[model samples]
Target: MVEFTYVVSSIIFGSLFGMMAIGLTLTYITTKVPNFAYGSFVTVGLYTSYSLYRFEAITPYLSAPIAFGIGGLTSILMYLGILRPLARRGSPLVSLMIATLAIDIAFVGIFGTYANYLRYTYVFIDSLNFTEILGDFSIFGSQGLILAAPLTLALITIGLYLLLTRTKFGVAMRASVENPSLARVLGIDVEKVYVFAWFLAGGLAAMSGSYYTLYSQGGIATGSGLIVEIFAASVLGGLSSLYGAAIGGVIIGAGENLLTGGGISVFGNGVLDYQKGIPLVLMILTLLVFPQGLASLPWIRVVTRIRRISGRLLGGIRRLSARGLRRC
Candidate 1:
């Protein structure tokens, strides 16, 4: 039963990790720059949840929308006020990535200051480094997040798929992603598409952060700590593919949780401290072994060969069955 709980927890955590990473992947696809401030958006969402709970005493469920809105608005502002201007002036991808880092640092400082203010003035939270203010609640003999995280991930994945495949705005966004100059020539407002993509990315990151508060300790360093894991997941998944990001997040999540939750049985208690390094190790390994990601692994050719063989065997079996039936 304990081991089972670990599996469930890992799955939920992985789902949330994926949720945060998809936005990073999206921004990378559209702008060709990884937004290092992406995790800061998650930090904003975490604080948004904290503020809502402190002021209104509401559950995270109620605060999610507000968190998402604030996150999206902040992301849009970052793009329009900073990134857009720099990009227009022909800033390189490295410069844009550096700008995101600056944004992350500035945001972290602001978050820390706000946390201190709340602690000093309202006495709401005792420590910005760690807080278990709203402890986890259960549902159906499992943690509420066991249900919420997977459901949220599924909905977001499906919604994004539908939006990208079915909607006009989504089509325009896809066009912009593929070729901004051509999209513009075709009368697509590439800048607007970029803005909307950033909004969605920010909103998703924030929503993931809100869920993170339910399971982990909330603090100023929360986002900073998570950024490494988020990047690991993104890089593992094939940085250019959103679905790959989701898969990468789940893999890292499960590995991290599985190790931390049950490593004492397998490798003894000393492994706990090493748990934080799991994602970093995975990131390095992924880069070394499959720099193009699992999606582009060389074994894909072998798999395709096996699939074709199986397909031919199935067709042969059907043909033999039909021949026997005709003979009968």
Candidate 2:
């Protein structure tokens, strides 16, 4: 029962990881650049929840939608104020990534300062810890995150699929992602698509962060600290594919909880302290062995082969049936 509980807990964490990574994947697909500042945006969500609770005495769970809106607004502003201008000037991808890194660095100081101010000004409020709020809500001998994380993941995944496949805006966004110049020629506002893409990415990250605080201890430094694992999951999912990123997030999540979190260590004992290194190792191994990521693995190849064979067989059957009808 204990081991099963541990596995269940890992799955919950994995679902949250998938949620965050899917956002990163969306931004990468549209912009062709990995936003290093993404982690900072998540940190913003954490602080937003913290502030709501401290100032209004509202539960952190209620602050989630607000956090998402704040994150989306922040992303749009960053795109309009910084990234857009830089892109218009034909800034290189490397430079844009570095700019995001700079944003992350700047946000670190900003969050830290705000946290300090909250602590000093409101001595009664414990701004750093909100585990108590999470404790208030429980179901089926489990915490809220066990339901919240997976439910959020399912909704976002389905929403994204529908948006990308059914809606006109989604079609335009996909076109812009595939070829911005061609999309512009087709009378699509590629720039607007880029802005929307960033907004979705930021909003997803913030939502994930809000759910994260329910399961884990959170502070100003929390999101920044998890950036590595987030990046690893994104890369593992093939950065280009949202579905792949989601799967990658879950794998990395389970690995962290099961291996390094000391549920059942493959590296003998005392692995708890080394939990931080799991992401780095996974990232390195992924780059070395499967440069294209898990999406391009042997199972994918097998599926492709099966699809091709089935298509060929169906075509052959159609041709024979058509010939038989002609003879009649």
Candidate 3:
């Protein structure tokens, strides 16, 4: 029963964290920035939503859409206004790195300038009471939102997969990702593709941020505080693979909870405090071991091998027939 409770906790944490992991992967894979702005995106959503809740005559649920929109748009604007220009100017990688750092600092300044330093303040949360939605496990209110995160992420995955795999725009964006020069040669608008990718990632990040605030209610101080862990989850799953990042997040979330349970011991310390680091440690270990990620685990490899063999055999048969027809 305790294990069951942990699993629930894992799911809730995993789902929210999974969203962040995906956002990080999207930006990194799509733009190659190795973003730290994502943490700020999380903070902005929390403080922004809390401010709206405090000032405006709106309910938590009602303000959700506004919070989500603000979070998404704000991030997108930053990339467009700041990062994109730097890239266009043929900035070197180190220069771009410094430019991104400047953007992050500018973000902090903007927070104080606009948010009236509320970005630095913390909000106290009441004991979460949600015995109904998740059964008798009795978790926090935010946990419910966290638990629902997976559904949101799943919808996003389906939508994005279709967009990239099934739609023209998606195909163009992927071409931009794989080989931008060739894509441009093929008459695809590379800049537009990049802009759309930024929007997609920004929107996802913003939703993740809003969901995180709803769950933690820790306000700005702890909002998006799990960034390090999110990075770890992405790495553990293989930063290049979206599905790997998602599943990796869930497994890490659950494993952290599991290790904190009965009879668990590490470094002769309590598992609770060290739970956050489990993902980090696993990330490091996984990178060192299966750097390609569990995406290429033994079972996956076996299936791929069979497919390769079948393709080769089929190609041989086709070639033989073509050669015979040409001779005739």
Top-TM-score structure, candidate number? 1
Which stretches in model 1 have alpha-carbon errors above 4 Å? 133-137, 298-328
What Cα-based lDDT does every candidate model obtain? 0.85, 0.81, 0.67
Put down candidate 3 lDDT per residue, 1-328, tens digits, no spaces: 2355566667666776677677777777777876766666766655555555555634334555676677678767877888888888988878876776666666666654555444335332321211111111123633455446678778777877898799988888788888989999999998777766666566666566655555444433343356677777788767876777777777777677767653244333455677777888888888889887766678777899999999999999999999999999
RMSD per candidate (Å) reads 5.6, 8.5, 10.8
TM-score of model 3 vs. true structure: 0.75
Ranking by lDDT: 1, 2, 3
lDDT string for model 2 (76-146, tens) is 88878887789879999899999988888888888878877888888734665445344337877777677
Candidate 3 has an lDDT of 0.67
Model 3 CA lDDT for position 101: 61
Q: Which residue runs of candidate 3 sit more than 4 Å off their true CA positions?
A: 1-5, 57-62, 112-143, 221-224, 262-269, 296-299, 302-328
Better structure of 1 and 3 per TM-score: 1
Model 3 clashing residue pairs (backbone): 142-215
Worst-scoring 10-residue span by lDDT in model 1 = 126-135
